[model samples]
Target: MSAAWSAGCVRARSMLSRRVGAGGARELASRASLEEVLQQLAAGPYQRGIRPGQSLEDAQRAVAATVLWHLRVLAGWLPREGAESVRALAGWFEVANVVEQVQQPGTPPYLLGSLAVSWPRLARAASPEQMREELAASPWGDPGGSDPRTIAVGVQFAWAVRVAERVPRAQDWAAGGAALLFARERFLAEQPLAEPAVRRAAVLLGADAVGSASFADLRARLRGDARWVLSDVDGPGELWRAEVRWWDRVARDALKLLRTTGFGPDVVVGCAVLLGVDARKVRAALEISARGGRPLEAFDVLA
Candidate 1:
């Protein structure tokens, strides 16, 4: 790690320490309405983008923008070595942009903040073939380039590959790969295999391990470090629970990284991840509140 990367890590540590923990998130989640939520958030850093009467989707988008803006600021403090890791993480949003385009080409883009500069070009493609051709030179490569469904699978597959290749730690890579496999299998299990692109993504993401197979088989193929995520899952319906479990593991790993006094790209990545988790928890809590439920009753802090 260069001196600049270390310096960036130091700055990230200072910023991350001030993040709202579970207790604070619960307070935000306990609000009775969007107006109350806005008032509470206005007392903090989120007040700038979030406004009164904002719909849930718009509020979430604003929250995303705030998080990405923080990431951009952190990236500016790092050297290329540190900055590249942050950018790699942000690249997920680029894949998301493609997914949105495939799902709704005519609709305006919902995600506004992205580190990838080519998102505009990729987002403009009206059809799967055009999108695949546009992404031919990108890291997400072409996944047989057929239709929107196939292109979506290909984009997700690309993300799985990048997670394994770009993350610096071997253990973290294994966890991430396992999470992808679990989510993909659970989700695609419902989709008909008549689509060739979906079938390809299934194979690439190891979805076959869970298809028409017993939980025993699925558990056997998972990475050893990640097997615990499925210790309680018995069937497909329980997969979302397993996802939350995996997120807990991720949060723990990130917290462990942040605990160190040292500074580097890993610290920057940890801060970004922790902040993202915080936002997700807040959203989950607020969603529960919107549904006339109390905070922390439905969702708990993973870390």
Candidate 2:
């Protein structure tokens, strides 16, 4: 890992440690409740009813907003440097405008076509042999010796479409149908992946794009926390698939935003406010992170 990435991770650890505090990593390890949170999110109305031409725009905005909000919180979240980093990463808001123009029940076709375009560019880093092996893998992980990045994204598109396919039908759903469904699957499974794996998985699943960061900073910050055990991040893994060139972009943008002048905690607060989380809980988590970089009752705050 580069020094910058390491520093960023260290900062993340420092901030996270303060929030979780005193054996808090274990709490987070077991806390993957999304149903209650989803239910709550669903109970609330969408910012506005979707108009005939607004579905895609709404999806774009919602996804972008959600990512920006979470990242913002994590950025300015105390432990000054970590807070700053989160703030810095918020710059690439343009990424969020991706699918803002498609129609309803929209996750499948719209996102599929997007993958066709995005996947190729993303897989440019993979090697020839790695690409060949990947294509021989899952429903979409295959590269066909075509463009590995494209193939990678195609798999992500498939995963998301599959996840969206599983959505529970209900009145008053807030986010897009696919996000809700995929999130539901993740929560129901309560599958806890290592932070990096989850980060990469989320990218593959098309949440936000990812870039690898240096682990040194994170290592230093994580020194005090047991739950920050990085077993999952280290692996006898796919060499090509292990890290990405752009993951750092996510972190950098977050950092830049945090360093901007005149933006108070409210930006972060307003961002979080939009998340459907109890403001008090997020605040408490931030407060804890600020104090000692511990993990908050992040898992328990939902629902």
Q: TM-scores across all candidates?
A: 0.83, 0.22
**Residue-wise C-alpha lDDT for candidate 1, range 103-221, written one tens digit per residue:** 76664553534366467678767787788888776656766655676677666656655655565642454444544454454443644322433443343334554353445666666
Query: Which ranges in model 2 have alpha carbons more than 4 Å from their true place?
Result: 1-35, 43-107, 111-150, 153-249, 261-303
For each candidate, how many residue pairs have backbone atoms clashing (under 3 Å)? 0, 54
- Give lDDT tens digits, candidate 2, residues 49-157: 2222333334334433443444544543344533432332232231121211111112222222212323333233235455435434533344233343333333433
Worst 10 residues of 2 by lDDT: 168-177
Which regions of candidate 1 fall more than 4 Å away from where they truly are?
Answer: 106-114, 145-147, 170-188, 192-215, 301-303
Best by TM-score: 1
Q: Give the TM-score of candidate 1.
A: 0.83
